[model samples]
Target: MHTHHQLIAEKSVIDTIVLSLPFILIITIYLTAVFISNKKYQRWPFYRIIFFIVGILCTAAALIGPIAESAHTNFQAHMVMHLLLGMLGPLLISLSAPMTLVLRNLSIKHARMLSKLLKSAYVQFICHPITAAILNIGGLWVLYTTDLFSMMHSSILVYTVVHLHIILAGYVFTISMIYIDPTPHRTSFYLRACILVIAMAGHNILSKWIYANPPAGVGKADAELGGMMMYYAGDAIDLVIVVILCYQFFKGNSYWTKKAHSLS
Candidate 1:
């Protein structure tokens, strides 16, 4: 078993690259962008230090920690890692309101670029709530139902692609459902909320499905336990999103209410 596990760990060069690249790049790119924006606007935030620390911790847990090492040998561990990377981490980072920070920090020109990016067709298609739901939840369905999950540790390309999906899907999903950033491509509050409900329900149901119908290579008991973990843990992170959205909605309503009273 030790030899077998060790052999499993001895992944291809591509796998090594894939495993490290996103972890490296996302932090690098995001920090760089944040720094540039901050410098431009003279916005120095101490909270940013905390964001980097926790963000890296979450990413490392999913990628380089003992949890990641065990993912090849244990299906439950892999599921947990997926939740950390693709669900919790993205959701938390989104709550950090990084995009807003950037917008507040950037010059008008850069803010306009950011807005334009949000409105672009590529962004519109990928960042739409429905599309994010498909990518985030549907990707899980594919990974388990197909051989993708089992094969991830073997090939770097597969692992890389899968990791990329996790991050992007998480990112797109967060941005689509929540209003942390200034979006030029705005969906109606009702529409976004309705989609959020459907997507959240779908995610919870997928966990149950995984429990009942264990994916290949994973035992039914393990899958069930893992699925349970996903159901509760995902919601804990999601509640913050719910709170933020409601706050934004209520704040907007209050502004309108005050305006109406003033006009009266």
Candidate 2:
């Protein structure tokens, strides 16, 4: 019993240190980039810097501190962590336009190379709305339905990989749906809107499934609460995405229409 407690303690310490490293690194790099970029070119948007910081805090809140510790055994806490890590964090970070900031900071040659990479076939494929949806929503379905949830709790490596996937998949999914950054391969607003609806439906369905059939180790009560949170909260964030996409679509159309009228 003593040995087990000691092992748990050791793991907790390790998790704290390991998890903190990334957030610290991200903040440092981001601030440095912003500073250098502002000095060289037009000052970077102050609000975007705040967005990036808040996004980092949201992700950090999910990964570190008491909430993260509770998440291992508490399904409700885990769901909250999921919302922060995968949805809200990604949304705010996407709004920050970090890639655009980076492009502005980089030398012309490097920026061109980065832009070229963005235009590459692999980038285009992964950034497609359909593919992003599969990676994001499909992955959640697999995790909650299979033994993966239990395995993630048991194994540190699995936990790390799952969290990384959640963050990256969510970010990719958001960017795929909305054009906050310089998209080299653009899709029509109609297609993106359709894909967003399908993806959100998949998410809603998965939450309902979790409520009906709890994950391996999670209890029914916890599952119900988490499912509800996932449903309503997820919808709220998704609604924001919908509103932004619609606004941008109509705004762009308006500009084009006026341009056409002037030409005529």
Candidate 3:
């Protein structure tokens, strides 16, 4: 039995490394691209590179290490992974302006092709604040409210799909809320703000629900602790998004106001 347990542990370690390899390669490729871009154009901000690295590291830490291993058995650790993967990681990556960097590095023809892709109707619809909010908050609702959470633990493919959805939904929601990257289908500020508020409320309410009605197979105490972590940590990250949005809104207004005064 001890030998069997040791083999299981070793296999888990191997699986973790195997799962993490793709993400590590992605980060390496991104950093290499950024480095090449900086060399080509001295104007690439060093801070953006730092943000990208930090964002990738946050994602890696959540998905590839002890935290990820614990998350399978510990609700609190799962909440931490959710925050890192779904909120902080997405926000930091958005701030990195990766699309902008890619556009800068691409040839004009390729850049135009990318721009055209961004303008596609499907991209436009999904990038809408309302749609993004639904996918982001609504996804969490489905996962926790249904048997999906428990189901995910039983299937590695489902688990990967869910995590991928979390990251992608979070990224789309973050970009919709804030104009960090080139948004060909930009929604009005008021509309985006309204969606953001509704999404945040939904997220918080779900946390509270989980507190009272724990997910399948989760202990009440563990659920409560996880719920609290999700609530507080999510708010902390969302606050950053709120601040950036408000700053951009006010700064744009201020700039236009100054222009009006000058014209008068």
Candidate 4:
């Protein structure tokens, strides 16, 4: 019994270390890119570095430690993890402009290749606001409304895949809405705004659905609390994205008008 307990403790430690490595690696790579880019070009923005680190920390906080463990059984905790992994982390990290930093750091030939990739039809399609919204918000609807949520807890592969999808989908959805990096395939502001509204409605509707119909294993009380958090907290983070998108639109319109007037 003592040996079995010791084995369990060792496995727990291993699990934590494994979980920590990705965030550590992300930070290290980002800082390295910042350092190289600052030397090659003008200094990379200090605030961007801070934003990247804090974003990564937010994701780490959700995936590791007590919150991650509790999420398996407690719906409220799971909701918190979802908010961190999907919405807040992605927004902050996108604001860091990691792709811009990478472009500055890469060789001219490699940079062009990356640019070409970005301009590809496949990239443009998947990065479309509508497509990203479906993947992010619609994916959540499928997960909560189906047996997928319960399966995620039972299977490690399912859990990892679901978490990865949440993060990637969120990041893509955010970058689609707000252009923080160089997007060769840019959509009109009005179009993106329309898509954003639709996506927001989908997300809100999903939260209310979760409130009324709990997932397979989650209890009623937990579902209620989780649903409320999902509704309100999701809005708060999304509001930041809306504000940024509006500012970008305003600046873009001002630029075109000024150029037009100068030509006249």
Candidate 5:
């Protein structure tokens, strides 16, 4: 017979697997599509596959493991989850170039339809750097400032919604700021850089505010640690974005300069 502790551990493992099933399924589908596309066409970059796997793992770590379980009672744990789910996970996923893969996989008709939808006013508006920054940073402000943080722990539905919003908002913000894939709505590099700086400031300011005024139920010590994590960890991730944006901008400019010289 299994020992009591062993049985409880097995049950916990089963529960975690059940909770993570949807994410696993989504990852599986994405890999399947990539595999099919690569077999039919040119090979996909190995780096993209690594990025997608790491991104999904980061999300899974935040959502289904000890970190997630501890987050309900520990403010620090929750903040770590926020960093993983909102910043690092999105950055990696966006870098994976999922949209490019999807476009490549689709038939011409479907690709054209998708292209049209991408250029639609609604998509254009939401994908704008300004709009994306507002939703991403604004959502964080609301969650940390209001009682939403405390409430999320109590309601599964609310928790799920908030997590989904964080991931999507982060993805939108990253993609808007950095051209990982073809963007129907393009803003100048300077404009996106300015917006990115402002968003970073907003995020850091909110972390400091949290440090001073802990959320409804969070303790001062835990809040301070969480705040530090948010400020530093967030900056680390944002730094990668900045570097990538600058690299792409300079590279594109150089390419055009060469073309212009050749024409001359």
Candidate 6:
């Protein structure tokens, strides 16, 4: 289903260095902040350092890797990028506990300011499960299904905006599922699980749609491979989140049960 022309087009590089630069800067900045947070507050742990590094790599790869850059040329490629930035990046960063580290590093006043920012209406709205679901999966449906995919390469500004959305959406989605920082609005396991199911369905359906209809310049076969990648990768990352949420729930429940039994 993929003509040689289409396959080649899917592999073109508009400017790899242009794209790679900002992501590298971001990774550098976050890593530096992680170090500063540790030195300032003595909160550095080995596992967390690894997580921060991995999260940086995931985002950097999505923006700079040849495969990823090629994917940007066609609808399917962009979808693949979304999975890396919007799903994998956030999940890894969330696990690293960036929010907690930031809190630890700040003075009481500054930490209080951060808490207030977190509780701001914008944060509240973005981190809400439904809103995060919309930003994560809903964003894909918008890009691949319409003329937006074609528009991506035409404007550098548009390209930058879309990529930022992917990263931010991922953070929102991840923070909603776990408690790394404090959340003013928390959901029950049943509620979060229900939302996850719907989110996964959105992803699967979009992948299948791409398989059926490759966007401009994307071959059907490549679309299938990309779509399958999106489908499988999403499920795998989400499974990790589900395991974490369930583990936390059980851990909390067990602690409360022990305390109750002791009192009784």
Best by TM-score: 5
- Model 4, span 1-264: residue lDDT tens: 569889988899899999899999999999998888877788988999999999999899889988999998899999999999999999999999999998998899999999999999999999999899999998998899999999999999999999999999999999999999999999999999999999999999999999999999889999999999999999999999999999999999999999999999
Q: Which stretches of candidate 2 lie over 4 Å from their true place?
A: 1-18
Q: After superposition, how far is residue 9 of candidate 5 from its true place, in Å?
A: 2.8
The whole-model C-alpha lDDT of candidate 4 against the native structure comes to 0.94
Question: Per-residue alpha-carbon lDDT of model 2 for 86-139, expressed as tens digits?
Answer: 999999999999999889888999999999999999999999998999999999
- Model 6 agreement with the true structure over 184-246: per-residue lDDT tens digits: 878788888889889889989998898888766688888888788888888898888889888
What's the residue-level lDDT of 194 in candidate 2?
A: 93
Q: Is candidate 1 or candidate 3 better by lDDT?
A: 3
Candidate 1 at residue 19, lDDT? 70
The C-alpha lDDT values of all candidates are 0.78, 0.94, 0.93, 0.94, 0.94, 0.80
Clashing pairs in 3: none
lDDT (Cα) of model 2: 0.94
What is the per-residue lDDT of model 3 for residues 196-241, given as tens digits with 9 covering 90 to 100? 8899899999999999999999999999999999999999999899
Listed in order, each prediction's TM-score against the native is 0.81, 0.93, 0.93, 0.95, 0.96, 0.85
Once model 6 is optimally superposed onto the true structure by TM-score, how far is the C-alpha of residue 156 displaced, in angstroms? 1.4
Better of 1 and 3 by TM-score: 3
Worst 10 residues of 6 by lDDT: 9-18
TM-score ranking from best candidate downward: 5, 4, 3, 2, 6, 1
Candidate 1, residues 78-190: lDDT per residue as tens digits?
A: 87898889977777676566777767767789989888887899988888888888898888778876788778878989998999799779878888888766776777778
Q: Candidate 6 has which clashing residue pairs, if any?
A: 71-77
**Better by TM-score, candidate 3 or 2:** 3
- lDDT, model 6, position 77: 59
Q: In model 6, how large is the Cα lDDT of residue 92?
A: 87
